[model samples]
Target: MERRPRARLELSDRAWQVLAQAGGNVAVLHRHLTAAGGQVPSLASLYRVVHRDLEAGRTLPDRAVVRRDREERHTRQAMADLALASPRQGDVAEAVLRLPRSSSTAASAVPVGESGAVAGVGLPAGAQLVRTPSVRAVAEPVGQAMAAEGAVCVFGDPGRGKTVAVRMALSVVPAVWKVTWVPVPVRPSVAGMRRAVFDALALPGRFPHTSALADAAVAGALGEARVLVIDEAQRLPVPCLEYLQSLCDHPGTRITLVLCGAGTERALARLPQLASRIAAWQEVPRLAAAQVAPVVTGFHPLWRTVPAEDLAWIDQSCAHGTFRTWAALTTHLQNALLTTADTSLDRALLARLCQRVAPPL
Candidate 1:
């Protein structure tokens, strides 16, 4: 048997800086540090640091050790504008103190339930109507983006409810708003995306079929109430994403942009111009172990018939408590109950379904 190499307990400042420069790529940093001297940490230690940061709050896999100066200047402009909104700080301070603080701290913040409880409120919902703290988390930024008519990106794993959360958030927008939702095309390309935009906003045929004119037409159609939501935005061509960024900068017709998909951060990174201008970057989280009962029961009437223990099993074993997973499993079970005479969601039924959805070793 071979022994695994252990990670160093402490790393030198030079090693840490190298790791940061490498964008938290431990292997690269390790090679560099080892070539320089023996001060570098092993991959295990790197994983430890990454996992700890992830558990704490940071969602990105490789978060470069960032400093304030690295932040884009325009991103802070919004904060300044918000601060300038208050003519008198004294009045705003007094009012802000009276408003809720404990809950609105961060998107990941959850309410404290009784001792040993999940520390969050449960909104009994069903199907597309499923409501929870996670939805509220995604909604806040969307609402702010709507107000600022800026840009936002919502990203998460598959079936994590990114689409549903965006829909629910947009539902609260005023009726006067002109919204266009364009789904990603099968074979993504800049030209295809331009066509999609033109069709969605109903741009006139007389307009020249050039990217510049398309941007002009889209911008002209935009107002404070106009918003374009691109779903599965990760599949978008890099050029198109950057082109949309140009649209964001169009003189007076700044429209709100909501880009929702998995791996959205990576896609945005490819277009630094667009990524820097993003007003909000929200990640929709999956359901937790404790939320199995509340979310499932409220999600659909079928869940009411399922046993609580079975619900927990499905959450942990099958669906993993994600919004789409739960909804899909529910559908399969509902179909089983109706078409077949199963009529029951026993552990055996759930196990079989789990195997169908996600095979276990």
Candidate 2:
């Protein structure tokens, strides 16, 4: 007996456009297509089509290429602005430091924690919040943005405490302001985003079925003085970002939007309309060398006992001034201390723990 012909998978023009808009992100494209209400192929099938039909044949640009182009454009714009404002002395050094560093290089040089928990990573029991320079630097802008009902974008490499800084800043806002932290859904879409906002605001009614009704409900709730903090905002696709812009632009809504994420600046770059309206863009850098000892010691009691030289070695060897790494290292050190009767914190012990957390060199 003859077997039936295997079905073919093809992406329509609209789907292709969605793929392009998604910057060749197969997962996001698949989500958008599925959400748009159609019989979309399985993710694996879509990946096969994207790689074999689109990428290999050059019908679509590679994601890396798209990312590089965006980065170059941003770098040029930054350089121009820096040139205009920068003083003559130390201009080269300042420019080098200010330019966006690639994640790989930053990771090689430096280092998910829960959103807004503590120090971007969840605070271990008995851990104290240390006001590092990055945290202090973010607080003012965050406060100003909340007070003015403006937008602020807090972005940096992951695990550097960007989320915690924003949370700390929001903590001080006067009791009158209703602060809502909207958790960004994985592979988010406009609809998912709307639901997140509705749930986050604790609106009285169920989420509306249609876009118009949902927007109406969201805008009505946002009419109150509210600070909407969206953490992990870098996960937002273009459509979702546009949806946020719509809420912020709504006349009835009195909302201060704070977007926090790793690579959030690059995400915002995809939508200049939203980026242009932001009042402040705060970047949380890694803990500086000088701050490592003081900040890490303050972050946990365990670190207080570690000698300064050893702490410095830990930073250089693994932690690289990254709070998340430090948090992980601290946990490991704590476990070692508790489990082993004669455990000592030293370079040899740190090397073994660092191996667990640090990526292979």
Candidate 3:
């Protein structure tokens, strides 16, 4: 792709005067433009002019800041060249992301990679399963609880792989079961959760006005063997939690509720009636420092050739033992590789990779 220079905005002389009065501050200029009764364009338009002026040395004080910002913007996009995708679409959001129940998955017995080879994620690309300790810990128990007609709660810090762990559990579910995933709304309500379940199950007609009628309808839809997977349960309101509890405890309803979220225990504690019904509670922990290299090596091709010491430094500097942090690091690293075509991963390169996100890496 050929690079194109941004079209500069020709602001009025009065606008430039206001900008100068504001000391090259775009926000202040925008405010002044609004206050002076001029038909001001959007803030973004003002930023473009300021940025354009700074780039050509029209504003020296703001130049250093704008240049650093521009450098980071480019750095963030650094890895677009290497992204490979195997796209397939299914549920918009499954309560827990799972391999379709029809797909057969061989349990990955491959221990975390110890070999320093520069190949890829070792596993076949189309393999249905992505096994890890956290996934196993979550999958096995949730499966057991659902089988026994019990409720389970999985909680942990944000981005600790709670959702992935649940997906791993869902892979082995027999085809006979109907699993419903109800995502909690931003501001949870009893009515919202009921509607979400009703929508997932494709129940007949709109949600009933009465809670009892809605509960009965949902229970009927979820026959003898069913699982309700609730992601982001921490955001669910007390009434919403109680509503799920009603379904879980109903003798006629053979529904097993698996709730995954961060701070779910604390949230559920406020709803003691709902909390008491939970048969199992597990916390998904972040990856340890020692396990970073093998995990990264198995996750993608980009990190396979990264040296062991550099990998550990990456784990410390940005990964910070969290799955999401590792993901962030990998994204930046991929862009870095694409940008510079670096032959080998080095400390300086690693620091540069995370400069946009962390403090001086």
| Model 1 TM-score (2 dp) | 0.62
- Give the Cα-based TM-score of candidate 3 against the true structure: 0.62
Clash number for each model: 4, 0, 2
lDDT tens digits by residue: candidate 3, 1-361: 9889876567777766556555577798788778878567799977877788768877433555555455434422321211101112132122222333212222222223322111122232322224556766776667667656678899999877787667545644544455677867889677888888888888888778897888888888775567789988999888888888878777778777889899999999999888888888989987876666555565555665677888887777776767766666677766666677544577777777667566551
**lDDT, each prediction:** 0.65, 0.74, 0.66
Model 2 scores what on Cα lDDT?
A: 0.74
The segments of candidate 2 whose C-alpha lies over 4 angstroms from its true place after superposition are 1-121
lDDT of 1 by residue, 114-202 (tens): 22122122322233254467776787787678666678899999888787667655644444456688767887787778777778887
Candidate 3 lDDT at 109 equals: 23
Which is the leading candidate under TM-score? 2
Measure candidate 2: CA RMSD.
Answer: 22.2
Q: Best candidate per lDDT, number?
A: 2
lDDT of model 3 at residue 71? Answer: 44
